[model samples]
Target: MREAVRKESEIFSELAEICTSPGYVHAIASLCYQNNILIYADKLTPEDMLQQFARDILVRTEVSTLIGLACKKQLNIDLPSPEVIQRYIDKTDSLLKEIHQSMMLPMEYIFDSNEVSDHNFNPFRDGLVLREPIFYSGESAYYFQYRDLSKIKYEKDNDWFLRNKGFSIQQVIDVVMSIQSLQNDKAKNVLRGLFDKNPSEWTVLSAYKFTAKEVSDISNIEIDTVRLVIESFVSSIGMDEFNSLDDFNPKNAYPIIQLPEDEYLLFQIYSLTQALYETPFFWFNDDKAYKNIANQHRGEFTENFSAERLKLVFGEERVFSNIDIYNSKDQVGEIDVLVVFADRAIILQAKSKKLTITSRKGNDNSLQSDFKKAIQEAYDQAYLCATLLNDKKYKLVDKSGKELNINREYKEIYPFCVISEHYPALSFQARQFLKFQETKNIKPPFVMDVFLLDVMTEMLQSPLHFLSYVNRRTSYGDKILSTHELTILSYHLKQNLWIDNKYAMMQIEDEICVDLDLAMLTRRDGAPGSDTPEGILTKYKGTVFDQIIRNIDKLEHSEIISLGFTLLSMSSNAIEMINNGISELIKRGRKDGQHHDLTLEISEGGLGLTIHCNDDHESISRPRLENHCELRKYTQKARSWFGICIGQKVPRLRFGVNKEYDWVQSNEMDELVQDLPKPQNLEGKNKINFAPATRQSKKVGRNEKCPCGSGKKYKKCCLKQEWRM
Candidate 1:
């Protein structure tokens, strides 16, 4: 078979070249080959041999052509002629009419053939009529199937076998059926012969089967239904109409599976599972999904400080590791831990009671409020934990009058104590609070994983799938709003509808479960009065509006605006910095409260002020504050103190200083120098004197005229006028 196929390949190659030149010689040669005119090999010219070879090539190359040719021969028709094509078609129609007239005959033919087959005793293989067909072992069998013979229909006739005319559906079916019924050796011979006789019809048949039944279940159904389903399924596949069997379910006639008794849906289900299982797994580890998830599980944070402090430094690597020293010292409340070399001490508070919340009877949203309260309590506990770790003196104990001590000797000693999911909302809140504190230069030690996990769980409303969302937006980040935060926002909005929350609906498959309601309820206030779009966005904007706050610095400072707007927005603790700056200015004893008008005050060299002060009574001296003022003195000391004055009628200064500084004074007031320094000490330096020189009254000559373009007398144009003036 291999040798024959190789020879056939060579013939086809020649035929390809012959096809390029469509002359009668090549054409007739091709036609003779198409007709399978293989004469005695020793009695033929090269052209005749080539033609005979081409005929064999076309006959054996395809299954449908082989079957068609057999049909033609069975009906006793010549190849490559109009009459032969009609006869082949007629034979196919007659065969189908005969089969439909007596379906039992075909069934009996199948039964008798199977009984003689080797595996006839097996129930699964043989009891089912089409499960095991006597097919020639080949690669094409991978896609081959026992198709229902009755379903095929030709959309159009493509009969190239009988001199370019076409064969009908019945003709092709009959030919294929007859081919299938032959014995293995006889079938091969018949197929080779049919290929020689009707190459085009066989090609069409091969193409039809090629198009049908990709991944289908056909274990049960009536024969007629099977025929329709198989026909539709095959046609669908051939035409590339739908991408998957899932799409073909609704269109088929036989409920898709002809054999309905078996668990056919299981096959489709398994197929779907395989598809999902085989999907790329790059997301498991290094991908954002994994990283986001993995970071939630943290490890030891070994930095420069911890590296130097070895457990063995004090002659024992296991110092306190096996001991329960804190267990004996059951003193409750806060304890201070010395940081050795640092001046700061750490505070540890023992929280005796496990943090929990209670609902108030008057509140309609007691459950929700309690949930948030618990979360905040947890956050505070975590922050307290961080504070203890950072300073080494704080601890929390549950309500059982139990003293909980965090031992530094343990490997898993996180900055915060472990809390339950009941306080989930607190995790993110606590994290944000700690971050704010850190930004304010407060040192709070928190486990990186604790912070990430807590924040992730709260924000995502899912357990720690830390790896999943690390590189993607969490629900919190999705909209400037969180669906979980909407409940709180609803109360603020004075509306009961928390209905348009989509993030709450997300199905997150992670370990930590969160009540998304808490997330959706948290929202910022709206803008001042107007309910415009800008107003709404402004209203909802929280600390995230820091960009706009920074921009506000560009405006002239108004004390009322600073105190009422800026300070009111800032934390009370943060106002300490502003108060200290203002106090330092006040102690200098300059009055005029010019510093109160922060815009002018900043221009006058006080730290640019805003209304962020805690109290108005902190300052009383206004007139004395402006007494030391000197805006632009040109003395050596002033010049040395300020850099070169550029493009101005005022003294030099920095970006923060303006022309208004002339009205403000420094505490260090000194006398201005009147006499200029002598050149004897400043020759190499840039110092210059403005004193007049000698020989200034010399007379001008007549020809020494001005160079101006007036075109007047040399003395009158410019030089004479200068002398007279």
Candidate 2:
């Protein structure tokens, strides 16, 4: 596989002799046309298509860009015919595909050597990219973070973008923002302008490609200026002459691709977002004269961007920026941002450092260093704040040295680390390298870039919904394997994001993001994706399940987060079964002679649930339900038991019971448990209710049959047993 990659250099070199620098970038843009990319998926499922494209010939052209930097030299020779050019493209593609296939077995052998396989099944073998070429829809704050940030610090001489890139950041932003403000573009330009001449020839790639004059007209900027700044986004890599060369930092790195016909193509919408959001990451560091001041201010900008996004997701009053923690008179540490709402809190640390290009190319030492600077250090800072927030004695103060008033001592603390820009393979690398300290009080830190934070805030605007997602996302830990954080987040928008058990590994593919992308693109006043989508959590919306979850989010108690954790962690099917049982009990009550109460066992942490259907008075029904719950909790040896009452005679949610999480395994239930009923196990690992046909209680007369179904008087039928105590 390695040798095949080596031989491909020769092919790129042969092809480069015929084209210019922009030509190489152009070839990649043309080959990845939405039409060309999806041709293979026509007959296969998305997963299968993703598999096919991962090893397809069309995807290998990007390598030629890296190996052959065409801006340094130019060929004046006439280019080959269309047939000849395609032959070279096909040859390079086949060799790259062969090399991609060859990588599977050897990588598996290496993984099996040390064997992290014991903890998880090896998914490293499928090193496939999801190729979300049309993902960004301009809702993110990519432009806000990097545009004209240094104007305040440096005045004009050392303005970061101008000093480093010889162009005003604001100018580029004007063009990008204008292009984004097109006619109802659902991630593709719906504006049928001069650029889309001859619909037959124009593929999906043409929708994003635009002429400088068109941009100038829309933005009201000078055509020459628009042309220059737009050119800054174009990669200077042209057609490569086949050769293997030493790796070096690219002098001219751009995300956009330029064509011979004078149109600029953002092959993937990510290219534009990356340009506005991440372009300054290297530029600020590379400028020798202004690097110190520029880098410091860069970090501050990242902190500010994160603080704003946090404020949007969790309201402004709850979010405090640049917080200082003090114990007594001495300062403990500083937190970039701290959010405390209700009983849920978030500790955030922002870093401007990015993964070096060498790290992306697979240098282990560089990967570790870049990961440490970009994520690990931020996590360390957030974790420090998290530990302090857990203790009541520490005071969180604002810049004025006045203590920030908190509503309550937060129980569920979610720590986060936000970066300045996109880091390739960030999620996977964190799983491979992140070493967490004690995480009992707070969850594992979720690391993401500014762009992701923008999208997350836009979609999940409500504090409760965002906090619930953060709770569930952190619970999964490294069990989630994905190339991007957005993929997992996208799944949460469509379905309840939870796995059945701890050891199971879940791979969230990028294809899952298609719906989210389209939603973001086509959203207007007419319609839009719900702030919270229709998923498993919302399946029983307004039912007892929703009532409990909503009420939990608003309540104040030290141990209340524990209950929220259980409810949020319930899988999609788990909530369905419990809610469905309520409906079935109501139907059976209409038939006259049938069981009304339900006792079901949840597979989550040995938890059990019992819904009492009868509308008997609280004086009798409440205690009877409690007694029934206690028996199930002991008999099943569950961690906790929840008892609920829904009415048939009085059809509304009346009351519920919270069996304190104090289960103790002992000989207490040995004799009494032998006769008690249990929920039957049904098909599938993710079943909510095991047995749907179990019963509960009511006020028992001395002569009436025992609630346990012993068929004897309550007084004589072992009601005085020590187990009830």
- What are the models' TM-scores? 0.18, 0.70
* C-alpha-based local distance difference test score of model 1: 0.25
How badly does each model clash, as a count of residue pairs?
82, 9
Q: Candidate 2's error at 696, in angstroms? A: 16
Residue range with the least summed lDDT across 10 consecutive positions in model 2: 129-138
Cα error, residue 602 of model 2, in Å, equals 1.8
Please name the candidate that would achieve the greatest lDDT relative to the true structure. Answer: 2
Residue 60 local lDDT, model 2: 22
Q: How many backbone clashes does candidate 1 have?
A: 82
lDDT of 1 by residue, 345-393 (tens): 2221111111221221112244334433433343354344444433344
Query: Pairing residues by index, what is the TM-score of model 1?
Result: 0.18
lDDT of 2 by residue, 1-725 (tens): 43433343454454444334333433443454422233322232333334323433333224434324444464222333445446545654564454334333445455555666486654342222111110111123323333433233233333555654555656666777666554125234332442655533332334556788888888899888888778766655443322332233232246565656776655444345445555555555666776687677777777887788778766677788889989899898898988887667888898877656455444557767888998998888888888888677888889887887775466568888887655655666666667777555677778777768867887776666687788878878878876567777779877767776745888877667655553443332112333334564356677866765665554433334454556666665666665566677776665553337777666534776777776555665666677777778777777887776666764465666767667776565555566766654322435334334533445567775566433334674435441344
In Å, residue 129's CA in model 1 sits off its true spot by 63
Model 1 alpha-carbon drift over 4 Å, by segment:
1-483, 486-725
